[model samples]
Target: MSASNQGRIGVLLVNLGTPDSPQTPDVRRYLNEFLTDARVVDMPAAIRYPLFRGLVVPLRAPKSAKIYQQLWTERGSPLLYHGLDLQKRVQEQLGNDYLVAFGMRYQNPSVESALQELRDAAVSRIIVLPLFPQYAAASTGSVQEKVMDIVSKWWIVPSISFISNFVDEPGFIETFAMLGKAEMAKHDYDHIVFSYHGIPERHVLKGSHNGYCKLGNCCNSYNKNNRYCYRAQCFETSRQLGKALGLTPEQYTTTFQSRLQSRLRDPWLQPYTDEVIKEYPAKGIHNVLAFSPAFVADCLETTIEVGEEFKELFEEAGGKHWQLVPSLNSEPMWVEAVAGMIRRN
Candidate 1:
């Protein structure tokens, strides 16, 4: 490749971040920034600020910091470590043609830094790919907004393209299906549950172009009316992966997990993780496996929440087997898949 052609395309991988350290201050800073985003909290700062600063951060930070302590390893937060690995692997696979960078939406190695890396490389074209598989305003859209904010200030902004979502991408489906099938083969599970991260119904409505997202079958249909609906995209993710794994509609179910707060009128994804675990025993389902595809790397949500908490609940509910399908953390195939996706774009 000619010197001038080097770094022609920049691929930026963005994910929800983790604290720089397990300390309370670091965790608090991370959480405060993450929760305060209008897309994430979806309330006026006048109202949400008090709740987040006075109540949520103060109360949750210490506890969450402890959780981060447990999750932190020698390489630091698993999310950051795996993100770095993914960036390296994707860069290697893409050769010298593409400049690859990774960033977290919340904490250290931020979107700003990633864009700066691309800028420093003098990339001619940039592809911003949020690590979120499904399109959620809080996650993917937030990343998009930040990327635009930075690029808009650039004196020489290159051709910029944002990947809206890749829920139905063949490589993505194959990667999830391979992992799911491998997990299933290890145990004869009676039920397979696809538990994605939850978002408030109002967030969906805010992003909806029309009044189409009712948060019900409206999502399941995957039509133009519900195209950008996060809930619908999640269902489509499950449906496509299940079909690839040869799972019958009755053999698997989709639910949302990791809801931090409750809404009276607003609906989140139905059949929360705990409820699904509790009801499985009554249905004669002794074995269950959970796939948290919402997260690209195993964080507290996947490790403690799904692995430990849900495992205990299923065991208490008379379930004999409980397993969690692992996240796609720089697996070679996944690295190739990400590179392929970028190449196609």
Candidate 2:
């Protein structure tokens, strides 16, 4: 195919957003937009808005701002910068045939703006790749909803498609496995933990195909019934990564982390990362290597929560050498994987 024929494809890459700045006000603005989204919070506007703005944002923002302050680096948010890097390299890989734009679901470089860029390029079709490997209502679903909402109003709409979930994609599995292997080469890790962001239990049930998800060992295997179930997808991603890295079932544990609020009565995906980390030292599992596969790039959750906080917990509990295998941020294989997925879709 000539370059002109390949130019027919437009690619938009989306990720969960980050605050523009680590300042309290900026963080508050981010929290306000992110939490207020019904897909993330999953409550009616009456309850969601008031509770998030009045209670959650106020309580979380300043503390989160401080955490963000620590998380920020010379290039600003690692998440944003890495995403930009991925965009540039992926564009190069796809060559002149593709126009690749990156955007966040919440803050700067908003999803609408990214889609507009693609629309302006006048590509015949646009493919949206939400960076979340495991689909969830709050992440991928919200992006799908917003993209359709924006394009439906266009005077001339192109054929829009979404690459929703790619848990079984070989490129994704191989890339993550390679990262894990690199870390393993440096340290004799006693155990591996695959941490993914936690969503409310209701989110899983909402995606349940005829009650296939019971939130237990039901996720041990992947199948059509639980394909879109975020929890199941998380497990599957871990399973594939584990298999790729030559780990047995007992050698690794897959758990959820970063629940929205600890006080919320509603349960979330369990075996919380924090709780599980605390128990590891007592079990004689020292020297752990952690993987945050759900995140394509290292962000607050991977850098601060998993790398720092969990390391502290493990050390305090008498463990030694807690290390984090960094996320795939513009890693060449990852870029190739993304490009191939785009071509396939």
TM-score of every model? 0.96, 0.97
lDDT of 1 by residue, 164-261 (tens): 88888887888878888898878798988899999876787777766777767777667787778888898998899889989898989998987865
lDDT (Cα, 0-100) at 138 in candidate 1 = 90
Q: Which ten residues in a row have the lowest lDDT in candidate 2?
A: 1-10
Question: Distance from true position, residue 232, model 2, in Å?
Answer: 0.9
lDDT of each: 0.87, 0.91
lDDT of 2: 0.91
Q: How many angstroms is residue 5 displaced in model 2 relative to the true structure, after the best TM-score fit?
A: 6.9
How would you encode candidate 2's per-residue C-alpha lDDT over 14-60 as one tens digit per residue?
A: 99899999999999999999999988887789988898899989999
RMSD of 1: 1.6
Best by TM-score: 2
Write down the lDDT that model 1 would get. Answer: 0.87
- In the predicted model 2, the residue pairs found to clash are none
